[model samples]
Target: MNLWGRINTLRNQIFLGFMFVMVLVLAAVGLFNYEQVSVLLRSNAEKHIQQTAVQATGKLDVLLRQIDTFTAQVATNANIQRLLMQEADGRPINFEERQLLQQEVRKHEAYTTGIRSIELYTTEYRRLLPLADDTLESRVPDEWISRVDEGKGRLIWLGLDPRYPDVVIAIRHVRLIDRSFSHAGYVMVQIDKSYFELMNAESAADNDRAAREYMGLVDESGQIISSDFPSDIEAAALISRQETISLDGKKYFAVQKQSDTTGWKIIILTPVDYATEGIAVLRTAIIVSVMVGGLLFLILTFILSVMITRPILNLIKAMRNARFGTLKPIPVTSATMEINELNHTYNQMVVSLNELIEVVYQKEIIQSRTELKALQAQINPHFLFNTLEAFYWALDEKGEEELSEIVVAMSGLFRYVISRADEDEWVTVGDELEHAERYLKIMDMRMLDRLSWRIEADDASRCVPIPKLLIQPLVENAILHGVEQRVGQGTVVLRAEPSGRKGYTRIVVTDDGPGMNEDKIRELYAAMESGQNDSAKGNGIGLANVERRLRLYYEAGTNGLNIRSEEAKGTTIAFEIPGEQGRD
Candidate 1:
């Protein structure tokens, strides 16, 4: 055939065939490029989040600690006490001394560098200015005085400053400390937004030179202490980024930090577009490259007829068979590892679908987790409360002081069951002792009959906050089932001794009352393991709730309850709860 006739014969097949080959080449290249780009982008994003959170926390800790240290020093200053002493002696500062004292107070304010306002307040409703030439009010606010009333010598952290926006902060009311400390007044200092800038490492520059980022200093109340975001951005309803909030008509990714000393929450916002912008760039690039390649293939359509058409047809057939689970390889296709490997992978995916489908459906898995939390909520609180109310009503009707004390014990029991503190779940052993004492005292008040309770706490466990309400419930439960149920004022001995440094706080509550028999003792063990209720013996929800919270918060191997009982003898409930919810 002539060249023209050959070209005409092949034109229809060749046109589409060459185009198809070009498409294959483009797709393979795009896939390779996409994989590399995606890995790098994901890795970078993850690292950035980890690094920023770590640095921000460290910086904040140092800043807050410095403030605390300075505040402590000022609290104990001799001159502050001297002025307080003179007032105590019914001697007032001479006019010059008053001026010097005022100047000194002003100097302290200046030294603070980040304080917005400072004032001296007296109960006589008198106000004095420390900085004599102050640009703003030197007197205490009406509310500040009310909060500081007679609360001298103690630090009272007040709420946000209503006058300032985003600059809401934590204020401490310290009554003058010491016997000679006069009731002259309290010093109120307003913390400034710039105080947080101390965390910045740069040579202290004008605030304008600070980073062009949205930074905020929050006090314990979770209000913004200050922010670099426009005042308008601050106006957005304070919402967490983990939730969603709109800004400037767009979304943003954000993070939050709750301050340790003040309980303030600091939030940082990044434009949502900024967060997803990288993904958008990669997506756009891939699409554009594929489109450009596809257009280029259109120009090569009129060449390479039979060979190209055969391979392309086989590729489509192979893809179809792989998807349909037929594993139909194109009979006479390209001899290429890449195409064959693609077929192999597709076939394996189909083969494994039965096994992997379970993973894909998360409904049951998530439902179980949710149910576990719900179960905990249901079992712990409900059992304790119902039993306590039952006890309280009995006390009221019978004029039984014994019942009242038991009710009090029951109330404390509930408190401990539910109280999860700000940072730790458990309170200290000493706190446990205090709560247990309250429980026992209420019981003693009720029984009126003498039920003696003794506590022996090791020196170290005094400050260790253990799981809340742990000690009392077991003690009261012992009283209810053992001591009070029997005749006479029962004796309950309480002891907590730290075994070792790893928060090994052991608590034992022993009662001198008729204890359980062998059958009943076995039942108690059964109740614990199965978490079943035993109405005959008083080891109901209080003991169960205490054990559950401790086990939930403490390290598994270290937490549980122990009970020893004898027929017609005494009973003791002993258990070990981690000193501080195992967090410390």
Candidate 2:
């Protein structure tokens, strides 16, 4: 069968409907749980990363404060201040003063672990301490001196000096701790970059090397002062408010905390995949469960559908046998109550069908006998024709020409009416018009000057086939009811021409006689629709018979006969006959 027919079967309907509903439920439950788990896991990951950022920032701030305190102690020392004052007076630094300043600088450097070196500079940018071998630049940058001045005794953090890119520097403007408290010199401290890596090491001690979180310190200018993931500094520094960001096409959650003392941001980047790894496992489990459950549902639904439709299939097989003239009844073998009821109804139907067959056979036999008797009683047309011919010759011998003509016409009309059997219903338009003319000729002869008639037709329309005797009845009605009732002479015209519709011919019979009123026309139409002979309406029976025969012979919806009349003007009756190509 076709697609619709296959889908319409009871087995497929039940199986598909059950599977559809099962899949919907499974999908809904799986999706709802997956989304809930995803949201909860992401929220927890964010909170955890945020706490890590805060802790890392706190540790770095503590280290920075300790370094600042150490630098402050060195800048405020009495020996360092007196030496700076003596240098400001343009006095040459003696061995004693230089030795005392060097001792003070060395003493403070030993107190801080990550400090590379400590140097003191005069107000004129001259170094006052002994030069260290690790120092890259002998002279302090003018930019550093200007920044120290801007600090006005407070510590100034200079992140990643180009002159010594391996270390971060902090500077302070030193002033005399004497009665005047005048400006003296500057103190600078260099801290090794390795000090920043300790934060990451402590935070990620439990994590594997591949999945460890990266921690970095960025200055206020978005420059990386120090970081374990230095290559990602540019991408990480751009993250401000977003919880997660993509770096080098891989997803990472970013959390940041700003230091209150140093004014730098401490950034922590954790990989998104590692944070949500458990959620991925949950998603996989949901998918596998749905697939396994769907397969089980499919198999169980198919089994149930087959069990439900088996009895119906058996009923269909029995019905098929009955359709092929087998009147045997179906046995009630199913345990289902509805199936048993259906089988019982089918058995009753088979019993009634056999009884109907018997009754139809008896009635057919009776009808055959009645038809045979009627045929035996029918008169022969040739016998009537010969008798009418004999009367015509007798009248001619008595010099009754008008009467002989009427007899000849009468014989032709009778022959035409009875010539065809029931099967031979169609006749050419020419033959039908000729038969109508013969009938009209007889009426004309009897009425004399009071009756006149004409026949107009084209050769094309005359050859077209129409139902036999369709034209003659109209002519008879026009004469008997119209012309006979008129006070003066009346005229009847018959015309055959192409109809307005393509492939059809119109034949109209018109009379110049007293016409019918609306009520009379309605009565005629009622009699025609009822297929009855109303003898009180003089010509209604003939017109009704013609209209009925036209409707039965022609295709349905064909305009059979149209009657148009005025009170005293006349009446016109017209109808169309299909052409050869138009007929069924």
TM-score per model over all chains: 0.35, 0.44
Measured on C-alpha atoms, candidate 1 has an lDDT of 0.61
Q: Number of backbone collisions per candidate, in order?
A: 21, 0
Worst 10 residues of 2 by lDDT: 131-140
Give lDDT: candidate 1, residue 555. 48
Candidate 1 positional error at 54, Å: 4.2
The digit string of per-residue lDDT tens for model 1 on 1-584 reads 36654453324455567667767766766766666665556454444444555666677777666655555555456676566557546676566766666666665655555666655544344344453433213333556555556455544446566766534233343345676444545555666666665235442242336323345655554555555666766523554445446666766456666666455556665443343336644665567666766655555653453444555567676566555543433333245434455556655766676556666577678989998997787656667777888888888888987667667676875666565336455456787787778777877776776688788877776876665566766876787888877876779988877755475667788888888888987777777667666444544456667666656766474548878888677997777655554354
State how far residue 525 of model 1 sits from its true place (Å).
99
For model 2, what is the alpha-carbon lDDT of residue 254? 81
Highest-lDDT candidate: 2
Each model's Cα RMSD: 17.8, 41.6
Candidate 2 Cα errors over 4 Å, as ranges:
1-331, 336-342, 358-362, 397-399, 534-541, 581-584
**Global fold similarity of model 2 (TM-score):** 0.44
- Top candidate, metric TM-score: 2
Candidate lDDT (C-alpha), each? 0.61, 0.78
